[model samples]
Target: MEPLMDRVLREWRGKRVAITIGSEHSFTGILEDFDGEVLLLRNVVDVVGNRGKAMIVALEDVSWIMLLE
Candidate 1:
């Protein structure tokens, strides 16, 4: 299997992905770009419905990633 980050980088583009951070925050969005260390996400919205048009999150901060079909 590919490294998780590499797999994430390869398979996530233009797809909806769910990211879990810490213990309480999770967001779903279209994967935009990753510059090796940070991820750019678009059309993001939290589980509770707070919308984020775009977001940049540090790669190290992510706990899990789920690719959506």
Candidate 2:
């Protein structure tokens, strides 16, 4: 079985994504890079050009990820 994140990384890399961690915090950013341990979210934005800093999230900490339009 393919890992879900792998599918996301292959199909959605460099695209905006929203990651909801543990049903608490929700992060929206461009899925720039990721590996075994951490996923890199770049050029994070909220409401059109918020352009917040990038965030590094541990793969273990991520609950699920969703693609954004």
Candidate 3:
């Protein structure tokens, strides 16, 4: 199977995505870019609490992705 990043890269652009990171934090945003080591996400909203706005995340920090329709 292709790597997780490859799978993410294939379908993430311009789409709304939910990302799980660490153990309790999650982010919902417009998929922006991933440059090997980091993921640049736009229009981000925190799922846990009211932490509105943009967010940039390191790839290693992500656990999984839930693609939004």
Candidate 4:
């Protein structure tokens, strides 16, 4: 059986998503890839007005994920 997070990540994959890895950091981008232990996001734009072409996020570090319309 798949872990809940795996199922959730699979559903969020290939879609736009916003995530907070910690209280001090958050980002919005396309959910490009996830390999159970980590996730890769493309074209990441953050709430604090920062942007990047891509980012690799560890699942353990993810505080939450919000699906973006």
Candidate 5:
């Protein structure tokens, strides 16, 4: 069977999501891509909900991700 992360990613691609990194940082954005090691997000917003540029997040630093849409 496909790995769980792969299945979730496939189903959630292009959707909005909220991701927590480490213990302090969080981001919300469109789930653009994930290549096993990193994630690409567009129209990103930071922890305080400040919308900014796209963000590239290293998978190792990700604590969890939640679908927002």
Candidate 6:
């Protein structure tokens, strides 16, 4: 099977996504870039709805990620 990160890179780049970190945080944005260890999201909004920023998230801290349709 293909690696999860590879699949994400292949299919999700430039798409809108929501990333959950642990049980307490959530961020939403466009998936600008990602590699083995981190993700770069543009046009980001944080858990409490703060907007218009870019966020870089560590892969190890991510609980889940979902496409925003």
Question: Local distance difference test, per candidate?
Answer: 0.87, 0.82, 0.80, 0.90, 0.91, 0.88
Top TM-score prediction, candidate number:
5
Looking at model 4, residue 22 earns an lDDT score of 77
Per-residue lDDT of candidate 4, residues 16-68 (tens digit): 99999876689999999999688899999998889899999888899988999
In candidate 5, clashing pairs total 0
Clashing pairs in 1: none
Of models 4 and 5, which has the larger TM-score? Answer: 5
| Global Cα lDDT for candidate 1 | 0.87
**What is the clash count for each candidate, in the order shown?**
0, 0, 0, 0, 0, 0
In the range 10-35, model 1's lDDT, one tens digit per residue, is: 77798999998875799999999887
Decide which is better by lDDT, 1 or 6: 6
> Where's the lowest-lDDT run of ten residues in candidate 4?
2-11
Stretches off by above 4 angstroms in model 2 are 1-4, 45-51
Clashing pairs in 5: none
lDDT of 5 by residue, 24-60 (tens): 8989999999988999999999988788779999989
Candidate 5 TM-score over all chains jointly? 0.92
TM-score to native of every candidate shown: 0.86, 0.77, 0.79, 0.89, 0.92, 0.87
Give the Å error, residue 40, model 4: 0.3
lDDT of 2 by residue, 1-69 (tens): 989768768789888899876778787999988998989998776444466789898989999888886
lDDT of 3 by residue, 1-69 (tens): 878777767677778898889867888888877777887778888875665567788889899877896
Per-residue error (Å), model 1, residue 23? 2.5
Error of 5 at 27 (Å): 0.7
lDDT of 3 at 42: 81
Candidate 6, residues 1-69, lDDT tens digits: the string is 989677966598999999999868998999999888999999999888899778888989999899996
The numbered model that scores best in lDDT is 5
